[model samples]
Target: MNSTKCQKCGLTNFATDLECKRCGTSFVQKTRNSGSRPKFSIIAVVMFAGVAAAFYYVFTGVQGSVDKVNSVEANRVNAQPVLPPDAGRSRADYDRYRSQTVANAVGVSPGLAEHANRTQQTDKAMDQMTNSRAQ
Candidate 1:
């Protein structure tokens, strides 16, 4: 290899030298593109490792949970709520009967009907304003 002078001490050494080889001064700071990564690069490596570990744990945990649910289903016919065998009919049935009783005879409040009419008029006015502006 060819020789070059050190910028700090002016000492001459081979071109492939890392240090001055005389004053012990470093030739230049190592960069990422230069062969191996430096020891101080732990931050980036640790962050990458942490993200990968977290993703791995999440994926494996989700897979385990899914497998557990599938196994439970495979071992049983179906799951049912913990209720008495002769449980009474649900409240929905009573509500259904009430709704049917009031279906045709249901009445709307006069105030609500007036509010709806006002809303329709306001919408029509706004539409007219927008059309006028566009022209």
Candidate 2:
């Protein structure tokens, strides 16, 4: 006949018995098999690492392309037109030409907004010159 050992009182009991007779402890046999636990595999780890690296590579490539396009647009918008050299011009004529150049450049290049302020100063100076000559 098969017998089960009581863990609490160390009493041997028949397998059919529900509880130990001496201490009233239940007799349940513990299995020593380790098959229920999960085992580690290197292939799973390597595959996960490869998928992470692929996502990083794709994200970086897209970000780099966007940055490159933004830089190109910035360079194009910031570019200023080159003007020809002025030769043999009176002070009033040169000031008038410069004012006209700045006025024409007002919405063409966003970077020239600061230089547009000089057109107002040029007009003020021209008015002063004309008023002084009239007086």
Candidate 3:
């Protein structure tokens, strides 16, 4: 069975074909019939392409912004000065100290001893608890 058609004269000789011997016609149709189930409409194809392009651009744009933010954060981490370890401090005090250090880097030096005292107070409280529990 000849599985191809001659596009030259509406001859359905074979469809999975290349060209008509009489007339050169591409058998593979790019557009489908309007009445078909999977009908191909110009408007529909354009709309789909447009939506795909929009989403692609939006995702790429947001990804670029995320990359920029991550780079900036990495730079901040690199630029930050590591503080010397202070004795007798809670985690919260250390966080505050880091904040102060960041502020100081930006030209606002907060006294390190202030929070250090608070850490010592916290340490004293913890010591009391430990002693009470031991008793």
Best by TM-score: 3
TM-score of each: 0.31, 0.34, 0.39
What RMSD, rounded to one decimal, does every model reach? 12.6, 13.6, 13.7
Segments in model 1 whose C-alpha atoms lie over 4 Å from true places:
1-40, 78-135
Determine which window of 10 residues in candidate 3 has minimal summed lDDT. 27-36
| TM-score rank order | 3, 2, 1
TM-score of 1: 0.31
Candidates by lDDT, descending order? 2, 1, 3
Per-residue lDDT over 87-119 for candidate 2, one digit per residue giving the tens place of the 0 to 100 score: 788899989999988777876777677666687
lDDT (10s digit) by residue, model 3, range 1-135? 566645357666455556665676655552243235576689999999999999999999999999999999999999999998788999999999999887676554346556766789999999999999999
Off-target runs (Cα >4 Å) in candidate 3 are 1-36, 87-135
Residues 1-135 of candidate 1 have per-residue lDDT tens digits of 487677678889887887778887675553223456555677898999999999999999999999999989966745645656535757897788688766534345666567778999999999999999999
Residue 10 in candidate 2 has what lDDT?
A: 87
Give lDDT: candidate 1, residue 19: 77
